[model samples]
Target: MVKCCSAIGCASRCLPNSKLKGLTFHVFPTDENIKKKWVLAMKRLDVNAAGIWEPKKGDVLCSRHFKKTDFDRSTPNIKLKPGVIPSIFESPYQFQEHSYSVMDSPKKLKHKLDHVISELEDTKESLQNVLDREKHFQKSLRKTIRELKEECLISEDTARRLDVFCWECCQESTE
Candidate 1:
């Protein structure tokens, strides 16, 4: 069966002459993360349900949607490189991910968008803080474990004999 480009506004197909020009058809990536990306590149909001896209068996994208680096042409059968994503799209509508409410003026829309961006930034900052704290806690926990292991072999001693308190936690407040 002839595979066609699944991307929006693309009509390229795997024809006799198409292959002579190095045109190739690629199935959607089996990797869920990569497959989602290809689906998003299709620029069809209707393709996804519950924020996930499930590609049909016939779903395929042509070579024109990717950069040269996206493919590994070294082998006789050209294959896509690891983690390569489709970057090219023909439709102008593909780039839009948001639409302002009809009730709002342009200025109001801009203000609302700015407010949403600020909230996103704040959330990102908070998530980073939590991750930073987790990293530091892990580091301190590792240090404590190392010390305890050194004092009494963890395998043999069962870590009961060694005082297991974290050094960072026990330290006097510098402030």
Candidate 2:
């Protein structure tokens, strides 16, 4: 006869004695010397989560748990609240995308604002340089014109020449 797993939500049945059912059993306390070790081991096999164990008659204990008995010993004492599943597993891709979206979503707006501020600063700086150069050029041209007039080097007929010279000098100053 086979026994069904007493574990909640588990439908696994006990290994059958028939070859088809494929159940294997080992002699309990395989060695007299190991018996003491196993007895000590079983004391530690505590499954905290399941709170119980359903073992079949003559079932060989797994070697992995040979040293420890209470299978649920390390599991947390966490109980699911009413109407809620105990496990919460999210897809890896969804978690990756969600993390990216959370971290990157705000950066988009911040980057745009930073660009705008930089453009404004550049514009302000360029305008100030232009204004400063213009003022210097105006002052230099006025002084040059006043000197030429006082020295009688500038005549009404040479007005165009003076204008050309002043324009070239102003351009050179800017460069």
Candidate 3:
């Protein structure tokens, strides 16, 4: 299964064929202290409960949340600098728990505000639809690549036939 960025409001995932090839995911730290810091930066919590969100072992954060300097270029594989925390975030669903219409009783202002909020919700839904489509595309692409890889391998008999076919082509070209 493809790992997605654990950061709230981030939709980046590990799709090798995706346009977001630059997107890299880092596993949550094993150390308790560093892990806590990472979780704190995430600003996520169990909605039904009080405690902060604790990531499972497979959970990861995408590179977009980190600064360019956070990566260690000296290493062949991209790696995070020690103790770096993800700071970048976009809260698509992080609206206030209560609407201002409750407190600010001006009906005219409230109507305009509600209209804007409605548009925001529609935009958020559209974004979610796009992400879902991308996920489907990734799954389909992976399946196609796997099938192509499987089809490319020739049995010994097929390989011998291919060699003969190539030789015939070469003779035809020469003639």
Candidate with top TM-score is 3
Q: Compute the lDDT of residue 14 as modeled in candidate 3.
A: 85
- Which pairs clash inside model 1? none
Question: Cα RMSD for candidate 1?
Answer: 17.2
Off by over 4 Å in 1: 47-53, 92-175
lDDT (10s digit) by residue, model 3, range 10-106: 7887898643477788999888899998888878877667788889889999889889988997967889998888788766345443464145458
Q: lDDT by residue for model 2 over 51-142, one digit each (tens)? A: 33323345343222222222233435322122221121223244445544346657786997899999999999998898798878777877
| Candidate 2 similarity to native, TM-score | 0.30
Comparing 1 and 3 on lDDT, the stronger one = 3
Cα RMSD of predicted structure 3: 21.2
Question: How do the residues 6-33 of candidate 1 rate in per-residue lDDT, one tens digit apiece?
Answer: 7766889988898789889888878888
Worst 10 residues of 2 by lDDT: 80-89
Q: Which prediction has more favorable lDDT, 1 or 2? A: 1
Query: lDDT of each structure?
Result: 0.74, 0.49, 0.76
Task: Write down the worst ten-residue block by lDDT for model 3.
Answer: 92-101
For candidate 3, the TM-score is 0.52
